[model samples]
Target: MTKLKTVVAMAAASALFLAACGSGDSSGSGGSYKLSFVQGVTGDAFYITMGCAVQEEAKKEGATVDIQGPQKFDPTQQTPVLQSVVSSRPDAILIAPTDVSAMQRPIEQATKQNIKVVLVDTTLNDPSIAASAIASDNVGGGKAAFEAIKQLAPQGGKVLVVSVQPGISTTDARAKGFQDAVKADSKFTDLGVQYSQNEPQKAAQIVTAALQKDPDIVGIFAANLFSAEGSATGVRQANKQDQVKIVGFDAGPDQVKALQDGTVQALVAQQPGKIGQVGVQQAIKALKGEKTETKVQTGFTIVTKDNLDSPEGKAALYKSSC
Candidate 1:
């Protein structure tokens, strides 16, 4: 009977302890189910879109989610957030690990108490703590970027990589895949990878610096929406828009404008709205003691002017999501 009650207590977590889930304090009203959400940064439209999806799912599931994260993709900032989340001892935690290795200890601590941890939008180095991880096919997405730009520089010119956080696994994987694809193809010449750290001004600064180093850089890879916009700006400021091709990951209103203007040749867009719905579905499965897939690939697709508003493109952004 005691064991059964404990099982029920653990299972009923979301409903019984809402505050602790995200508050970093175990004390709560009790029975009000809580969830903790630690993200990279909410400012980026991509992460913001992802958070919206998670929040929507939490609402539908009637689970209280405290979503907190760094303003930028800084592990130093998110580390304390993770620690505070562990301190709260919530029923579960949804984290987008900024640095997979740095996050191991906190996740391991939560595991010791049988608390649930779900990694969304990113992954961890030690995958043991997260019951499941929902993310885009980052490597595949990067490959798509390389394929799109290969034609522009068939003979292989310099390609500058503009990115947000340099250490994040998702960005790293995508960048690596893109570089590998270019390297494997003898026709391609690799430039180098640079960091924007997801800051618009920073991205532009880095792009400007990269351009100065390689005046003939044929392509620029923006690893996310913000960096993509900045990349376009950098190209234009240098009077090289028509000469340089820019490919971006993720999309928003600004990215759309860039695409239409022919500044951003293409974008790798992921469904942010669906990411929210999927997160809810997985959480419910966990609540019901049902088996869930360890890694659910949310997926990403290439977006270009040719398909910007086509039925297929609209369909991708439709269905109540990104």
Candidate 2:
């Protein structure tokens, strides 16, 4: 009888040990998850809004999230931040890769450690390693920008694109889409694209120079928020506000103000918060061993002065903080 009691106690202890081990798997089935969100850069209203949504969604899933981002939107800066996050061994990571190629290996490292990775906002050249990639339809957004320009400058004349650096998936796609659409229409002359290196000052300089070279340039497409800000500044500095109609991407508060103040003609607003919220959902699904959509494309809103005060426009604007 004594021996039988001892055996039974050992069997119970073994079962409890196995249960504890299974609960540590980070599988959401039995344990809370730890999630990390790495943004393209810190201090951008777009990313801030996304981060806020990520936190909110993670809370709903009973998971905790830590948000990190580089000061600049550069692969070199983002890699170190990612590596540090990977070392912390979070159950999942949602990141916006700064460069399509440069960020590939660093993100792969996270996946190799068995941490589920979801690409948010921007993606890599090879995105297969990530559990999911979620972002706005940047290419379509770019084409829409051209359409807005066509409407603003109905007669059609010389046009230029102010874009961020190449190899950035989002901006690159936007530039390509706009250029392709411009080519399709013979009425407009493509003055080609200029890289802003993600600097509003550089974008301003590029715009001022381009305007000087082609004063008759009737339309301009600024591919991102900073580019839009600088393009408006450049148009103002060159005193071409009345001459050049501008269509910009991303509707931050400043961009909205620019539209209302007539600094820009129209704005392409992406659903950044939705992307973040969906990113968290996908990561949680991946952790729970559930099916996830490999590639999810969110929609955009066109914000003009006509709809600046509308419900849709207000909902589309990015938040500065949570």
What is the TM-score of each predicted model, taking all chains together?
0.83, 0.92
Residue by residue across 1-322, what tens digits does model 1's lDDT show?
0000000000111221211132222332344457777877766666667677777787776778887888767777888888888788777777888877877786677767767777777778877456677777787778778887875556678787887776688898889878888888877688768888777788888888888888888988898878898898888888888778888888777888898898888777876666555765665555445565566766666777777777656544422223
The per-prediction tally of clashing pairs is 13, 0
CA lDDT, every model vs. true structure: 0.72, 0.86
Worst 10-residue lDDT window for candidate 1 reads: 1-10
TM-score of 1: 0.83
Q: For model 2, which pairs clash?
A: none
